[model samples]
Target: MQTIPAGNYLIVFNENGVREINNLIERNRYSSIFLICDENSHEHCVPAFLSEIETEIKIEIIEIEAGEELKNITTCVDIWSTLAEMGADRKSLIINVGGGVISDIGGFIAATFKRGIDFINVPTTLLAMVDASVGGKNGVDLGHLKNQI
Candidate 1:
């Protein structure tokens, strides 16, 4: 397996990465688990992910519409609200599955919610796999502009 260290976490590649995920989850003993996925990843990747995770942890899947247009403060608010409703505390873990949009916004939500929770990104597209899913950078656009601070 290819392991690229990114800050506190490792960006792992290869089929064995699933085993790595299981190991991380087991080691962390997170209070709860939340998965963020766009429509594409929800359909394409969640099943494979679910199969790979051997532990029977209670996982809540959050789905957002797939598109850059949905990446905004409104989406973040919805995600934050969902986490609150689902009782996600400081010890919860957020797994972001999908392309760059899911990873970026999911990371943002995880970082801000409950004053920061642990999150991992599983990129499902070439662009995201190469760029957005690694390096721990995440942000949303400001209206028509892109990557606005």
Candidate 2:
């Protein structure tokens, strides 16, 4: 496992980690829950995640094209547009549930929407789990440059 910088995050490790997700959501009691994922992740992981959250909480799943090329301002615009169309407001919580590209772009969209909202990262790929999401590092790539904030 990668080491997240000290005091920047709260680490929780469990064999049944997904179970913790629902409990975490309950504890925070966000107004709404939005799940961000790629097409592949939607097909592969989303069902299981949804199954874990048996609560009656409002949940919105947003799926984008799975690729590094899709990580950009345009994608953020699309996600924000979706959020608007879905009636997602500042109180909604964004849960990123894919690889690095999805997490990076989704986090950016959530961070900027309505001057920022709550977000959680559930990275499926090894690279994302090992590197990207763990460090509080986030942002989409700009042409040849990988930007993080």
Q: Which stretches of candidate 2 lie over 4 Å from their true place?
A: 1-8
The clash count of every prediction, one per candidate, is 0, 0
How well does candidate 2 score on lDDT at residue 130?
A: 79
**For each candidate, what TM-score against the reference?**
0.95, 0.89
Task: State the C-alpha lDDT per candidate.
Answer: 0.88, 0.81
Candidate 2 TM-score to native: 0.89
**Local accuracy of candidate 2 as per-residue lDDT tens digits, 1-149:** 23234465555556677776777788877888889999999999999888887667878888888888788777888889999888888888899999889878877887789998888888899998877667666788777677733
Ten residues in a row with the worst lDDT in model 2?
1-10
Q: Candidate 2 vs. truth: CA RMSD?
A: 2.5
**What shift in Å separates residue 67 of candidate 1 from its native position after superposition?**
0.2
Among these predictions, the greatest TM-score belongs to: 1
